[model samples]
Target chain A: MDLLGINPVLLIASLMVSATPILLAAIGETVVEKSGVLNLGVEGMMIVGAVVGFITAVNTENPAIGFVTAAIAGALLSTIFATLVLYLKSNQVATGLGLTLVGLGISALLGKPYEGIKSPTLQSLDIPILSDIPIFGRMLFSHDAMVYVSILIVGLVWYTLKYTRVGLVLRAVGENHDAAHALGYKVIRIRFLAIMFGGACSGLGGAYISLVRVPQWTEGMTAGAGWIALAIVVFASWKPWRTLIGAYLFGGITVLQLNLQAAGVAIPVEYLSMSPFLITIAVLVIISARGNQGAPASLGRPFHASN
Target chain B: MIHFEKRLNPSRITTVVTPIIAVILTMIAGGIMFAALGKPPLEAIRIIFWDPLFDPNFASYSRPQLLVKAGPLILIAIGLSIGFKAGIWNIGAEGQYILGAVFGAAVALAAYPADSVLLFPAMVVAGAFGGWLWAMIPAILRTKFNTNEILVSLMLVYVAESILASVAQGLLKNPEGYGFPGSRNLQQYPSAFNAEVIANSGMHWGVISAFIAVIFAYVMMTRHIRGFEVRLMGEAPKAARFSGVSTTRLVVFCLGISGALAGLAGMFEVSGPSGQITIDFNSGYGFTAIIVAFLGRLHPIGILLAGLLMALTYIGGELAQLMLGLPGASIQLFQGMLLLFLLATDIFTNYRIRIGGSN
Candidate 1:
């Protein structure tokens, strides 16, 4: 009972905070995949963002600048992948994997000096009267600006994907590249932009971790959150709002596990530690069992104009 | 404007030549990186690529270690290449490796003080079985539910890591020692040891298995129908299915073989070089083997050479770190750059850039 004595408001609030990174990443990847580009280097891109954001924040003592730089860094890394897969027509899977390797290695090398370094903290924006409300206020109103920014991004992505002509064209390109090309849509250019957007969001996610969540720089600090974000895209069935749901679900599991550990729950610490990964994957398998009809038809295939 | 023209027939010369070109480019890029870090570029490059094999001072020690390090990489890559050729990606060989080591060590530990020679062989089987079982999760899920094997397998690695930490700190803990977090040193146990067969040559069972696997894979790919089926699936899956190749069977076969080989690598490593089942026993050999498989162009002979080259970097990277005061991360960055360069140059194998071409 004591272990179960969790404050629901606090849990929901922290869940939103924890989910922000993956939400940012998954929503961004949703856009990229919607445009028919599959980039598995999200993990790599996020780590680069984490290190770059940490470094920028340390130097400027400004979290916003840190986040912007992280986005730039992430977008920059994505360009390498875009160039390889789109221009050189390299195998998408292999190139994405290579991108991840590059991101991880470069981040580690660059983050060496920043190791054990504390990042400048971002203050949570507490809405004056809204934050004063007993339970809901604390849950909904008290978070760093990035939390709201992630939700806003999600809403914007959803609106863009569902209502906009650009979204239709992106979807058409993903559904059938040749037809889209015949229709005079520039497939490569569109995919490149989408990938860059994905990179930016992933960067924001990484920066959020370094600046707000852990508030510290560590090697491989993003850990497997990038991978989880990838899974979240699939879990969301490529829908932005579902992506939000999936992220919060994952965030809930993560927060709950940590809370359980803190409360000295009787569960084996190892299982608790592994629950996020195991549960996320298990749920993905279950969701996929219903069918992954949401996957872009040309998702993993490289777009060759000639082919 | 220059545009790439698809080759009607991929150049045979380019197939063999691109890896070499990539290596040279890596050296050049790595030298620049060293220069950026204030170290003498040539000296850093030499220490990494040349000194490991030729320098009289370090070659004696590093040369033998090359095979020792390459042993697991080649064995794992050989198995992975087969799966890769079948379009079946098993990215969690690291997990399979850990489970294999755990199962093998558990067998030996349970049979403590026993002198039966069969014990080591039994452990090997148990190790292989453990890996096979671990790999089956993703394989079965993929076949039955159409789940993405890549995500499933990769996530399993984390689960396996948690289990590894738990086992090392709990059941497998060396009780005789003052609360240490590892198993009994299997290297010290006569019956369970994977000792070097040849004196100081690093010719242990794992290295021997790697060579055997290389030969076996080469022969299988060239002469076996199953190998042809595997290649067909990867190159053209629809055609493979039409040719009566059971997709489920191929997936199971490839995943099983890779898992078993990864397990053997872990078992040999734990009992011989690594000396015990520690929480940190895995040294990313399984993941690195993925790079090795690709670098080898998914060919057996190519994988062997790639494995050796990669191992050289590991040894040379450590040496460079010690001698040049370079960050240890520099090697990881260098290797990543090598893979990037390799993939970039691979474009030449299938296409040629032509001047003044329009589609």
Candidate 2:
């Protein structure tokens, strides 16, 4: 069925694809924050992932290998942030900004050669039985492998955080690093691993954009998706399940705007283009106004054993 | 194995020495990067750090360009340093700068045919107001709703960009220029042009304002009670609150001042150096100012020096881009490396390394 000269089914399908990158990034950041470390370099990590992924996919002619390399690159970059903030005690915010600068610059440098070249895009995976099951099948089951992986990752995160001993330890560290340290838990090591995982997820998200969404390399292609993912983490109240909802909502807005522009809607294109960021601000205000921000106690605080 | 011991007092010497060490380290690392890119490392390094000032072929042209570039950076960085000292992060100075330009340019555009001598000053006020208005969104939201200003301010940057794009294409489009998307070039308008006070000296109103801001910031920081309160708010928020410092007021004031300054910088740029408002008018000066603020150790005089040094790298980087086949992004990478090294080396200021010591 069509609404305002737009196909609802196609819009739903496209939004699922569009939301995967943000969903992956937000889920990853949620875990990092849960471990009492805040890495504000999500944009940096994602853009680097996008370029490295694009380069690898183009060279190897395998989108899978491209994604793998992007994750590795993202993790490697986050190691710089982890070492600086965790070991050397650099300011997390400044170091994160530096990481972004480095990521954007380095990505542009690396992606320069690959700018116009198109990589092998990800193919959609259709589950046999689900694919044949009418309208719901087309809406849900038909998507690239990464979309399914993103949702699966969200479910896994939810289950792990709610029921696993690992989750309990991570929560303990985030709530009180001193207590966790006193209790013989390795705060730094746990936090380091969490940060790397976050980086990897962010990398995958970026690769999704380069490989599946845009299907080509471009400088600064991630273009504030990383930042939006950050806001989504807050909008989701740091919950994994809510992150899925938040991503979908934002993805829907993005798709709707594009569709509206294509359909020649009466509203000014500038106003429509700016709606997502404006909505983000409004959402932040609303979420924060309700009083229970639910942020980790030691979220941005530095951890030192002697202290 | 080495371990760190907390110092009773942060070392005064290391505070000054670390930044220098960071710069040297950045050059070495940046040289290595250039070599990896298949260029001569030494030449690239020399071109970036040395050639702009001492290279006879480019010095005359690049030397004056230094003040033109450093002026806005210093102005924005000085304002940012204050809020940073209060532990308030206003990373959206980029948005504020853009709004300032849009607002300032609007005044010039509105009074297109007028030749009043007061037009430029009126535009300056409007520019500052625009930045202040943009900044106030985050400030008010943070104070009233307890929202994170960093995210809000940054998101508004995108919003401001949309506005800038809209105005450039719609409301502010130069009517006489056929179908171009940018606003009227303000440099041609005598009443609104921010011209150099001295010929070939690059001593425009913006550069003079930057100097005034530096002096004003230094005096306020060293002598004013508000300065002490700002420092206290950053160092120890609890104590500052207990001592009757209003958190809300400080947040509003700091954000307001920084926004206004950023706006002023934007105004100067659009009217003088930039000459017109276009889609890509802002070239990341607001974001770069954050690094300048930190590199200066959040000190006014230090920012003055750091702003000039940062500007040197910009000019030098451009020279390298012209002289060598290096990508434009290499300069960004170099600056990023500088900030990273600075952060890594800053550890020495507050802690001492103990070799093979047992806790």
Candidate 3:
């Protein structure tokens, strides 16, 4: 029931909750990279989603509306990046960094009034028969709608990327945009859509933090979850299913660290708190060292039709 | 419909003008934002851009603050521009900055009650080493394991922050004061204090170092073979490789120098303006320096001016925060706008717009 003064059941439940945001963000970014576009503004998009979602939920008293608006806001923000990088041919890295700065600054300004104000949170959806089952049900089947949605999204991404015609085109574009363009595929248009999708997913992840996770408005509440999601994409080698695993692993670590701190573990609190980032670095090194980094060949490369 | 045609040679005028245009655009957009927030747009603009330099009431105080603020930004940005020139991104200058401060402060703290003339200089070296050590993590990883330096460096930022928080509360805590989560104030120590070389003029050792860096960078970039290799690598990797440029060495050198400069900036800051190692000592200077680098067009002299301009915004933003009831974040929003516009307008530098072109 308990491991090291921590409840495994509760830990699993909370890990599912904590991992949802990162899973959503990483899955979206995988698609974006697959289209030969790299958006490093995940943190910015996530925070924007957090603030906008929290504000909407507080004002409308509807968590669903909050999430929808958050997605819209994120998509809208990503359009700026899409235009700059895809159309104007701005440096992808610098533009992405700019998006983050804009997102952080704008989110802070918007969330200023909503600070400390609690918003409507989602209720756990208990499937009747599953709820009646024993410990396994509690561990797996008792999460909110978004949790199910996140897993469902991952499944959809995996299937789409593996088997679909659209996925094939996206892969072609990512592998070599000029060749894709030569084949008469619309590279810029596809990348634009991919970026927007990425923004929306990042937004949803951010809203998950502000709504279900913390259930309140806080400036920079997402912290480095967005960045971690980015790391997960790499650790997953751009695979959706692996992203889920990476997210869960990260979520578990986060929860375990918090629990350890609460239980007054002998290790210094700061060291415990820093474990997730350190682990991220370790995983990144391990994945890269294996020689099959599996990154999209055209990842982070700016595309121009003439070029 | 309009389309862009790549210029055979990028327009020199547009290269200089685009940043100015970007600034003007940001002001207009920021004004609209301020108006939306129920503040007077024109007055807010004046407070942010104009008042910091010429508003008689605040100028004398703010003018000196400019160099104090610009010093670190220029130092860090100058270092970053070098790596950026080589197409090497070191966005983790923020982490490097933190480690530098921690390392530099550690030397002073460990040598507490000793008034040796060498204390300050020793701290400076320690600060640079700390930053270099931290930067080496990503550099070594990139060279050996082929990991993305951007992610690794950024992740280390959180690690460094954790270290900062730990030391502030544990090892570096001020023993004479009540148990507070910060190191001893280095400003109070005569030997460690980074005093203003000229009173009220803000010409401190850090500002002097920034000037020196600018001059050094200018010379190296224009005259040195290493600088040519860096530029060549960014422009054409194949060509640089053909010329026998070692990618590993370039990566290491760029990351190393940038990290050292970022660390030096942090050292100057903790010993001077910040005065101690605290949880919130770094106020996003590392990140802001990125914008400064771009705005300066990665040119040393340009970065100096850009750093000063950025420092002006910081002072003016503070003035606006006090004079007008604008939120502190609005300034961040303004700076972000500046960078976005700069990027957006940069197309003019490299392309000629063709109206009614059928391609």
Model 1 lDDT tens row, A100-192: 888888998889888888888889999899999988888999888999999999999999888999888889999999999999999999999
Model 2 per-residue lDDT tens digits across residues A9-37: 88899999989999999999999998988
lDDT of 3 by residue, A1-307 (tens): 2237888988999999989999999999999988888899999999999999989999999999999999999899999999999889999989999999999999999999898888999999997899668987899998899999999999998998899998999999999999999999999999999999999999999999999999888777888998999999999999889999999999999999898888888899999999999999999999999974678999989876673
Better of 1 and 2 by lDDT: 2
- Rate residue A153 of model 3 by lDDT: 92
Error (Å) of candidate 1 at residue B9 is 3.5
What does the i-RMS of model 3 come to? 1.3
Q: Give the number of the best model, judged by lDDT.
A: 3
- Between prediction 2 and prediction 3, which has the larger lDDT? 3
Candidate 2 off by > 4 Å: A1-3
Q: Kindly report which residue pairs in candidate 1 clash with one another.
A: none
Each prediction's DockQ against the real complex: 0.74, 0.79, 0.77
lDDT minimum window of 10 residues, candidate 3 chain B: B350-359
Decreasing DockQ order of the candidates: 2, 3, 1
